[model samples]
Target: MIVIINYGSGNLKSIKNGFTKIGEETVISQDIREMEKADALVLPGVGAFGTAMEHLESYKDIIHEHINNGKPFLGVCLGLQVLFTKSQENKGVKGLDIFKGEVMKIPEEGLKIPHMGWNNLKIVNECSILDGIENDYMYFVHSYYAKPDDEDIIAATTNYGIDLTAAVCRDNVFATQFHPEKSGEVGLNILKNFVKSIPSK
Candidate 1:
């Protein structure tokens, strides 16, 4: 079973519907026991970084355990931000630190604050979640983006004034700054790839 972590800060239904559209079923739950038994874990959110992390406090340890055990994990939007060390979005509030990095606001040098709309991806490195998906447009909606301490983990990028981190992957962990669920066929393909990454049980 796939579990989409519901910490009171995400488009849970849209994510679940996306999975369902691809002939996969998902459960949206915050119950530790439910998450513990999931084949794959998905963290999808659209909200303030600090607030999301606070609500996710209970699942921190379990999330770490899931990732450390080599289980497939996917994070989207604010979900992706929380995987980092910290963020300028909410100073002093530490992130999950799954990937050593900091989130910063999109530079406001005659550019838009929140980069919303469609943008194509520049595949930086091969990541399972991006299988059969390259240079395809994906939907984005955010003002903050992650800057990993190690560039090696960057999987894809999209330019919006400055080259922004579009997606990241490290071992069993994967995340996207954009919303795959809202990216049409390209998004569904991404989710399908994620489903394929799950181990057979």
Candidate 2:
């Protein structure tokens, strides 16, 4: 079964509902044992970077181990940011480092600081999580976005004053800066894609 990590940062209920709507049963837990046995892990968050990292400290190793074992992983919004090395939102706070990258604030060039709205993605590369999703509008709510050291990991981007990273994928790790759970039908489809990518357990 898929486990939605309840690390005291994510919109737990909404994320759970999203998966439920897609007809996928999931477990929300902070238990290390439960996490270790999960078929896939979903990291959904909506909060400050440093606080999220602080709360996630205990589960760091398990998260890495999950990915290292080639298990599916999907992160969203703030969840996506923490996958990088560090975030401008939280100075000096180390991230999961699952992908070598830095999360930087969206340049406020007269545009709103937190890009809160629907934006169509520009697919950059092929990723199983984005199998059938292309140029579709996805709900985004974030002030910072990740800039991976390897551009090849960038799966899709959306224009918000600048071309902000909309999603990223590297092997079993897949993350979305947008909240697919809040993106309506398109979002549900994206979640479905993620579920499909999970190897049968």
Candidate 3:
């Protein structure tokens, strides 16, 4: 089983459906006990950063424990942002600190606030989740992006106004700033790679 963490912020059904389309069983829930039985974990969210983190706080221990135990973990959108140290989305909002960085609003000088629609990725490093996805268009809907203290964790990037971190990974943790569920074939392939990468039970 693959557990999708539901903290009242993610696009739950879409994500679950995406996995099911690829023939992966996923349960959307907040039950830490259920999460522990999974071969992999996925955190997908769309909402205010502060509020999302508040909901996720109670489950952090199980989340961390699951990942520390070497289960594959993937986070999407707000899920990706919340893994950082902090965010400007809601002033003084602290993140899970799983990665060193802060989220910031996309520079608003020239481009649209929420960079909506298709964009191509610039692969930063080789990652199994991104296999065969280099230069392919992926859907994006966001206003803020994460700024990692160490650039080495960046797995891929997309150019909006500037080069934005599209995806990141370190050890068992992998995350994307875009919604693969909404991103079509390329996105599904990304998820496919993720599902395939999950350590065998």
Best by TM-score: 1
For each candidate, the alpha-carbon lDDT, in order, equals 0.94, 0.92, 0.90
Write candidate 3's Cα lDDT for 1-201 as tens digits: 899998888569999989899888889988988988888989998889999988998888888888789889999999899999999998787798899999999998888879899899999987889988879888899999999999999999999879999999998889999889999988898899998878683
Model 2 residue pairs with clashes: none
Lowest-sum lDDT 10-residue window in model 1: 192-201
Model 3 spans > 4 angstroms off? none
Worst 10 residues of 2 by lDDT: 192-201
Which candidate would rank higher by lDDT, 1 or 3? 1
Per-residue lDDT of 45-97 in model 2, one digit per residue for the tens?
99999999999999999999999999999999988999999999889999999
lDDT for predicted candidate 1 compared with the true structure: 0.94
Question: Who is ahead in TM-score, 1 or 2?
Answer: 1
Every model's TM-score:
0.98, 0.98, 0.97
True lDDT of residue 100, candidate 2: 93
